[model samples]
Target: MNPSRPAPLTRVDGSPVRVLVVDDEANLSDLLRMALQNEGWDARTAANGQEALNLVREFAPDLVVLDIMMPGIDGMEVLRRLRSTGNDVPVLFLTAKDAVEDRIAGISAGGDDYLTKPFNLEEVVVRLRGMARRHVAAAAAAETRLRVGDLTLDEETYEVVRGGIPIKLTAKEFDLLRYLMQNQRRVLSRSQILDQVWSYDFGGTSSVVEIYISYLRKKIDSLGEALIHTVRGVGYTIKSAE
Candidate 1:
C-alpha cells in the first residue's frame, strides 16, 4: 500500500467497500475496475444503464462511476430512478460533453462528482478518495449515535441504553452489541460476527459469537421486548421491538 494513499473505506458491516463502474466503453470500464481493485475495493462493471441498475440491486455497491450517454436508459434516467427509490449511493458522472450546461445538468440530477473523458487516472483516484472521505464523515456523524426502538448505542462514548435506562456492558459485549445494532434487522451469521467483532489473534472458535450474544441478551433482551432474535439454522438479528 502506498503510504500517502488514503486508507480504503469499509462498508458499515466492516466488509470491503464495493464500487460499480458503468460505461458503454468496455475498455474504460475495465480500466476503472482494475484501478478500484488496486485501491482494495471490490469493483464490478456494467455496460449499460439497465445493467447498471440491475447490478445496483444485486451488488449493493457503495459508489458508482456512471457514464452520461448510453444507448438505452441513459445515466441521467438511471440516477433519477435511483433517487426516486431512495437509493442515495454516491454517483460520479462521466461524460465526453464538457459544456457548462452539461455539467450543471449532471450535478442537478444528483451526481456527487463529474469527470470528463480522457481524464487522468490518478485524478480519478484522488476524486474518489475525496468522495469516500466525505461519505464516511457524513455516515460517522449519523451513526455515532444509533437507535433502534427504545434502545440506543453511542459509538463515540461507548454507551448503551434501553428504555431510558443505562445498561452496563464489558468491552467485548459492547462491541458485540454495537455490531448487532449497526446491522439492525439484518441477519448476521456467526462467521460474519466473528470477523467484524473479534481480532485475528482471538483464539476462540465460532462458539465465542454465541457466548458474547448470550451475555448481551442477559443485559439487553432480558430488560424488554427482546430486540435480539435467533434465526433458526441461520444466525441472529436485532431490530426494533414490535
Candidate 2:
C-alpha cells in the first residue's frame, strides 16, 4: 500500500479496504471485482455463500456484497451463520427481490443494507463506500471518550473501546468514526458522505462506502449489536441499535 495514498476514511491501517463479493453469477462477480479494485480496494470474489464464508475466514474482508439468491447457502442463511459465529462484518444484500417484505426481512436478519437488482454499479459502489466509512470511524474512535452505543471513540489519542474493552483503530478509522458521531443518527446519502468525508468528488464509484462499512462492522458489530442500518432505495444511517 502506498503510504501517500489517501487511506480509506474508515480504516485503521490506512490501506486499501478489502472486500468480498459473493455471487453465483461469475460475470457479475467479475464486474464487481473490477469496479471495487478500481477504487483501490482489495477486491475478491466467491461463487456461493459457503465459498464466501471460507474466503471471509481467510481474507477477513471488511465488507461483503452478498447476492440473496445464490444456488446454495443463500445470502440470508450465510448472514445467519455469520452472526451465529459472532462475525459482525457489514453486509450489503443484492437481490432481484424488491418486495418491501424482502427488504425488511434482510434488515431484520442483520444486513447493514440492501440493493435491488438491475441496479447501477456506481450506486452500489457509493453505498458500499458509505458503509465502510461509518464503520471505520466507529472503530477509530474507540480510544478516547467518544462513544457510539457501548463503543467509545477517543479523539485525543485515537483509541476505541466497546463494552469496556479497548479496541485499537487506525488514523483513517478515527476520522471516519468522528464523522459519524458528529452526525449520529442522521440518514446520510452516499454522495453526501463522499463529498464530506472522502474530500473529493467520487466521479462515479460507490465501492468505497461499502469497503469502509465493512471495516466498521469488523470493529463495531463484531460484538453483536448492529448500529448501522440501510434504508432500501435510499441511503445509510448510524443510530443506536434498535
Name the top lDDT candidate: 1
| lDDT measured at residue 73 in model 2 versus the true structure, 0 to 100 | 92
> Over the stretch 110-210, how does candidate 1's per-residue lDDT look in tens digits?
99999998899889877887787677667768779888899999998998889889999999898888889889999998888888889666787758988
Off by over 4 Å in 1: 1-14, 147-242
**Per-prediction TM-score to the true structure, in the order listed:** 0.65, 0.58
The per-model lDDT (C-alpha) reads 0.89, 0.83
TM-score of 2: 0.58
- The numbered model that scores best in TM-score is 1
Clashes by residue pair, model 1: none
| Candidate 2 residue lDDT tens string, 49-147 | 889989999999889999999887999999999999999999999999999999999999999999999899999999989988977777665534656
